[model samples]
Target: MISLIAADEVPQPAYSSGVMLLIAAVAVGALLFLIMKVKLHAFVALVLISLLTAIAAGIPLGDIPAAMAEGFNTTLGSVALLVGFGVMLGRLLEVSGGAQILADTLVTRFGEKRAPLALGVAALLFGIPIFFDAGLVVFLPIILTVARRFGGSVLLYALPAAGAFAAMHAMIPPHPGPVAAAEALKGNIGLTLVVGLPLAVITWYVGSYLVSQFLGKRFHVDVPDVLFGEVNDGNDEDEKAVLRQPSFAVVLMLLLLPFALIASNTVVATLGASGAIDAEAGWAEFLVLIGQTPVALLLTVLASVAVLVRPGRMAEAQSLMDGALGPICAIILITGAGGMFGGVLRASGIGAAMTESLGDLGLPLLLQAFVIATALRVAQGSATVALTTTAGLIAAAAAEANLSDLRLVLLVIAIAAGSTVLSHVNDSGFWLVSRFFQMDEKTTLKTWTVMETTIGLTAFALAAVLWPLG
Candidate 1:
């Protein structure tokens, strides 16, 4: 029933299980070694390897292009706009000094003694409408500022804040990782959002905030001077960009708007499904229509711009929105390539191969999702790629496995959590965190790596605990 993934479309494989497995291993190994050792661009490596994987799997050569295109187009159809709007919103907030305002407000509310927690809380709030990389970029100045004034390990503030972004991005919809996974699995996106937000917050608190405070003491890191003095860094421009600082309430409202709309949609759908509301009623139709994640997020972006823009500077706001799309183009394309690779693997019978070997073991569906996602994440270094790929691989099995809708959604969460594990040298995020905090490889491994692993495991554990209840 999956779009573009009919069972009848899958070609009969000529390769033995051992050969198919070998091809799979070689495909993944080549992808990693090229991206890491040979220094190939990730987008190129993913696309090239996907085409090769299709050929090796014995698909007719002419059908290969269609397979890749279906995967790429399907993934981008859901992911591109959410990311586009989200990044635009983030750019506006960052360029307008709203991020600084938000951070300062957080510190004021929490007081200096608990400033680390405050920055983390701010990041958590700011992170809802933002991706990890973009959110961290905006928050870096504030994190550095807090670290400078407070005089302690940068990790004290940085880890919790960064971890908060990571947690939200990994678990929540409109972040692409979980969303693409849900799409591939044909699970309920609205239900995932409704169910996911609470779980994300709980897991972030236990996995990121508490764990961060522990690791903060052990791994002391000095805030780097990199962004402090650079003219183009926007540290100076951002301060004078705004006529007056935006109120914390305004920022908070914008961040929460999308979630509220998405939640309302989920609520209405649940009520209608349970016969609390007439499914055919106009109210139900309206709620479900506006409540779709893309529509909600898009509306949020539009509403934020209206509220956040200085009256005479609509043009500048327009520029910020336009500027936002360019930086994320690479990210969007790479994410599609990941989806393409996953599609190829699916067409090749990797999922069936796995089911044949492991399905008889009676591993809980949630555990299997986590294990597969974690392996792909560690091997490849892209969480979105790992997530989308794993979801595609397991899509057929998920359909045939007799899982409920809610369980399928939770399975997506489990996959997302798995994708968050063990960010090492292979991951760009590892280097991003390391360079930003001025930590060497060893320290980054000790600190950032540990925090990432904790977030993934904790999120997965929480999802597992919730599965039976579902």
Candidate 2:
């Protein structure tokens, strides 16, 4: 029957449980050491470790190549297209002035007095369709300008935006992490998004605003010279020309279209099952199928290129594509490698052993998720790694736990929370914040690390509450 192992039971492969666990730990540790200490590319490190794992577990020589190939091809097949299209979409938005338009529109509506709220909204809205790092770089100049004008800490504005981005980036589907988690756990993407949106709002306000308020007061440091280096003095004609432009309503609609379609499809499908709507309608089925995550993202990207690109903006569009693709290449490779790592673990029976060990501990699924995610997050600096690894470990456990769909969704959030905790020297996000804001390691630890922990803990608490209700 080619049965996958359940969480409560360990599969008996050719190797002993102890031997499998030991080999898995060593493989994971080697990958971490190579990546974090030796500065190897995560993709290479993962592939190397996958082979080492196969060897240590005595996986047949012939099967190893097939396993690696299958893992790589399967993951890239599902995700590479969406990621490539998504990168292009984000680039078009950036070059077409869509991001600036959204930022300016929010600032105008909210006024200078509520810039934080505006920044948060901007992050939430724009972040949905773009990578968090891309979103940050695209809008950093405006965020800096707002901070300079407001006479407060830049993080007073920046942190809220970051929080919103983090929440959506981790929690929502179509994003690589959430999408990977949904696929791994076999959960419904639409329901995950429906719950994730509200949770994201709560996390942003509480984690970003409240935490930043205290951190900003305690740090009270000036913006570093590196960050404010030779500010353009407001006379750059080209830069000025791009500001306050683009159609706000059109950009907003484009951003929301995919999400609205997906959400509406889920609602209709659910209600249809309860006899609230006709499930057999051609339009209903079409909407549901089109709203599938991959299709929606593809459609959005195509529509964005058509709507956002002006006739003369080819150079701008090219630049945006270059910029977006440059950063995403690393992410795409790492994510693909992580997928292979998971697949190798499954093939090696490590996932089954880990699930059995956790079941033996009698831990709640939420707590199990938290521990697994937090452990991986501490070991590796990548949240994507933590989320993917934890999801793989818990997939069996979740099924054995017989969790409701809502509880399974909450488990995804819990894994996100655990992955978010304690970002420090090992974490790249810490360094990114430190470099961009020109903070010393210590200050970055105090602000960015704490902010991440706050987001993680807040998300965990919310997940805990929601888990029981589910």
Candidate 3:
């Protein structure tokens, strides 16, 4: 197994644990001030703060760059490939009209009476491969169309849909938060998916769906005219004359392909372990290689593109793929920088220093995971940063807990669960919801903010409750 902790030992602290904790607090404060107040680009803020924190924590100046690089590169090794492939696959689905096809089919099948349910279902399917923001935007037109047609609270349709995307983005693979956390903490990618997808669906239903229904009715918000300007209903006469959308079945298959491939790796590896099948068998070995997270995602992207692109349109497809990569470059860099910050914290002996004390506080490992992630998430308002940083901070302590494979995966979800809580002004996602829904601050708080918290708490509760099963 790829251990979550880096190979090189953290140098002994030059200062006592209290001073080390003080330095960590001060450094984090500076990081927040720079990002939230000074409006520094997060990637820049993280890199600068990480370098300074290492020095303050008494890491040798000569070793600082290597330490940061160790975290950055190690995280990127897993993260870059999965994220890169995921976005490309999503772009193919987006540009080829696969998402639209799925949405239309969903609304048509479920009808406007159950439009909220329909949109939520569709969002869950599409959200698997794409980030939260991207999936929400893609579904916005469809959501707006449904809400307008239904002539009721937009929140009814919007909240459920938005919440679904948020749930998957927070917990599932191919979305950066869970993937990066898993990478940093040495959790298995295939296993995360194998377990996470079902966890996501169950919690989302219990939390995001149930809460949105209540809030949607109480809020009584209107659908914004500007968010999806001049959206046409499926009744439009020219619908057949426009671009040919992919079939709903095709979209569904493309979306599920990566999950299936990655899960196969877990299953086959399990059977091989039990001597039911030969681990070194040629067919099993081939399955194992392609079933690796990055490779599986790569194959899924290729398969999706092959199905999505039309004949004689290779250049156009290439251009769309290139466009997909551009927007994600910043996200990828920011994630790696977050890893650098985590790397610095690990190298400073904070994880080792805090392990015994935290364990003795009578806190369960799952609860500790949620609390740490929630603190970082609430303070900074970036789930990705919180997830990666918390993983680094607790990775050693978690390893020492030596929980079962099942429990360890649940802890990963618990951390992700904590990071999902309470989006506010500090969170970019807060603004994204506010502007998109045309809601003022108070309204966004009641609706988007609460729904996010609900989702987080629900997920955490489920993960913690599931811990005893391990």
Candidate 4:
């Protein structure tokens, strides 16, 4: 969503709309072949193809590197800090046994018969402030332990929790995809979180939880020994940390800390914009500053270390947070590269061409947003890239529509839904789940891919239904 070129600075088209569209198609095709077939790293593939696409689209050679860097830097300016801090919080929670505390309490409250539901509920809460990959990694041991105790397919315990994280990551803020999409589209971050939270829960319950029940019946995947080995076969006490684990109340409070802060800004800013409050008041300005997404998360992280970590274990806590950073470096870079690719498309006038073509097709803008995102997702395999590129493709039309903030957020939801569907071999997350669960490609296709499609369709259905109200 970052604009590399100002409105008046937009260059004249070098080719006809049809030709530019064709060039974009070919660029996407090459990008796919490189990543899915050649097994090139996504970061390398993105940067390479971005350069090539710029050349093919007739961007001046002199401006290409700056264009790429501008796109990359602008996106990272918003994404890296949030993702880094969120991952740090997640690691602190994971190593401190916070995930175990939440799952244990929830399962006890729900009783043994509804253990899967309890795990899902815990994941939904944990996922709000953490990225999908981080939350999933933290919960793997708990899911396996519960599945082993209850005696059923691991799918029963795993799918619901995984789906919850997926739903939140795709639709909610703080995670890079939706965060970047919100920034690109100029949507209200607070409102996107406000509208997206309940929609995600509903989408997960219907598309994921229910569908998981059906899949669990048909696909009986035994718990794998790959990660934990015979340790999972032993007592829960074996895996407990040496330190006294934090209570559920403390863990839940930590998770909700950012939400309370961010929501205050959203509420106050809305009231101020509508002339319901003194917009220029000192208190209002201070609330907005502390409520900034990165600032809120930063405050939460500091509070977590103080409350959750023992005074003597500061070094251990620091080490855990440092470990979290190493894994996310690739994710951050790939996201920045995705922004660069989208920027190139915009700079080359391909985005304008895409806008004109969508208009010629006469499809409603919401439908257009979903379909384009879906196609990009199915082709390239990275949801982040699809969401980023699709936002750029439609940003021109969205700006011209003069829509309200609510409608803009709905468009982001639609785009996210399109990106969420159709995960396959090319997606790293697919491989992560496949390896963790020890499922073959065929089984993964049946379970993960199908569940993803349902989630996407369900989200789009809700967004479409809500479009009129927006």
In terms of lDDT, the best-performing candidate is 4
Q: Candidate 4's C-alpha lDDT?
A: 0.75
- C-alpha TM-score for every candidate: 0.66, 0.62, 0.64, 0.67
How many Å off is the CA of 321 in candidate 1? 2.6
Q: Write the per-residue lDDT of candidate 4 for residues 3-23, one digit (tens) a residue.
A: 323334444458987898788
Residue-level lDDT tens digits of model 3 in 410-463: 988999998899775445566556656677656887889899999999999889
Tens digits of per-residue lDDT for model 1 on 1-470? 01233323333445775677677788877876787678787679878998998999887899899978876776667567766776666666666566556667766778777887777776777666566765675466567666766677889889989998898888887666787788889888789989988888888888888888899888788766543332122255544453234677877777667666766775676677668789789988888877776787788778877776767777766875787677667666766676677667766765445434544566667898898777656544567766876788788889998788889888998998998988864455665576557676568778998989989999899888888887
Task: Give the Cα lDDT of each candidate.
Answer: 0.72, 0.67, 0.72, 0.75
Q: With candidate 1 superimposed using the best TM-score fit, by how many Å does residue 282's alpha carbon deviate from the native?
A: 2.6
**TM-score winner, 2 or 4:** 4
Say which candidate scores most in TM-score: 4
Candidate 1 pairs with clashing backbones: none
Per-residue CA lDDT of model 2 for 408-440, tens digit only, reads 889889988887787654344554465556565
Q: Give me candidate 3's TM-score against the actual structure.
A: 0.64
* Residue 126 in model 2: lDDT: 68
Find the 10 residues in a row with the least total lDDT in model 1: 1-10
Clashes of 4: 1
**What C-alpha RMSD separates each model from the true structure?**
6.8, 7.3, 7.3, 6.5
